[model samples]
Target: MSDAVAAPVLTIDGPSGSGKGTISRAVAAHLGWHYLDSGALYRAVGVAAGWNDIDLADPAALVRCTFDTRVGFRDAPGGEPRVLINDVDATDELRTETAGAAASAIAAIPEVRAALKERQRAFRQAPGLVADGRDMGTVIFPDARWKVFLTASAEERAERRYKQLMDKGVSVTLAGLLREILARDARDANRPVAPLRPAEDAVRIDTTGMGIDDVVARVLALIDG
Candidate 1:
């Protein structure tokens, strides 16, 4: 961030099911700052492209999806983030495993990343911004004043995901979730573009057993001090 003009940004980067989304939202709300759910942007692009039957292999098609897609976030204090694509409520669909896989895949394309780079950065407005994603701190907001890398053991993350799905009445096995998570971990960590790793200046928070409030408080302290 350039000292002359850039607004403040607090980046929270992590893998799926790591509570990055939840924690970042809470912190943003608590601070009255705008929040960015960067993963949802990729997922929205993938889903919108799928709706139009755009070939995923064609980088041009994917690039067009980024421009044609309209994503909106409707979030309130003490509420879950709601995602809308093309003026339609896509919050539930965006949370599906299929959408996540698509996001992870399209995220590898250099064109796609280039397209969304400024889109993500535009979230930096007003008082501050709490941006959450796999590469927010490492790539999107490298100069953010506060950076947090939230993570958990694979087993623990899988368990957390299992409960969340079960609560939604979606039947899923724990073993399957764990296997999928590990697979995605390997994929994200080894992806050619923007691999999933913490920025050297980031504070790593292992959230394996800690509650949401505790993690939020820890991150808040980073900027508060």
Candidate 2:
């Protein structure tokens, strides 16, 4: 493939609260490249399914949801990612924990994955893309020139999530968050399709107690290498 057509992609895959979202956004902004929050795409899809009263358990419903869904990202270059569904700004609603659970639930549907696969790939256009999600490196952008799998201890991740929600004035328990994180991890790891896993060639980083800049620096160093 020509260099222009073969746009470089940096795939950062990890579970929730692993700092993938923050690090990927920073990297994309630093490089002046396009940013793809693949998780947000699924979250938006889940929100759309809920709005249409579609059953996420129904495989056919999942297929239709993916086909009929319209997700857009505003200010994806260097600002807070805002998601729009069907031309309507659903950013706030899609950021809720409820929406995230729905995303985790629907992401396991094979039909839904197939439907949105090309949509994710389409983001690999001119310039480049920093794609972040559970399976970005393994499934969404297997040919990405740089691949990093970020992770953190479950307890640490839970604490991080708790702090974020508390900062937003959302009442939540760290213990509850920990339980939910473990459950989601099990689900993601055991999902039949596109299960959460680092690609064989991926470099894994444990951000247990590291600050965002430290982790970002490590990833940037990897990119430089």
At residue 221, candidate 1 shows an lDDT of 92
Candidate 2 residue lDDT tens string, 1-225: 864459999999998999999999898877888888999989988999899998879989878888888898777444577788999999888877889899999999888888889999888976888999999999988889999999999999999999988987889999999999999999999999999999999999999989999998998898788
lDDT of 1 by residue, 119-157 (tens): 998888878899999999989988889899999999999
Estimate the TM-score of every prediction: 0.95, 0.95
Q: Once model 1 is optimally superposed onto the true structure by TM-score, how far is the C-alpha of residue 52 displaced, in angstroms?
A: 1.4
Candidate 2 regions with alpha-carbon error over 4 angstroms: 2-5, 76-79
Best by lDDT: 1
List where candidate 1 sits over 4 angstroms from the true fold. 1-4
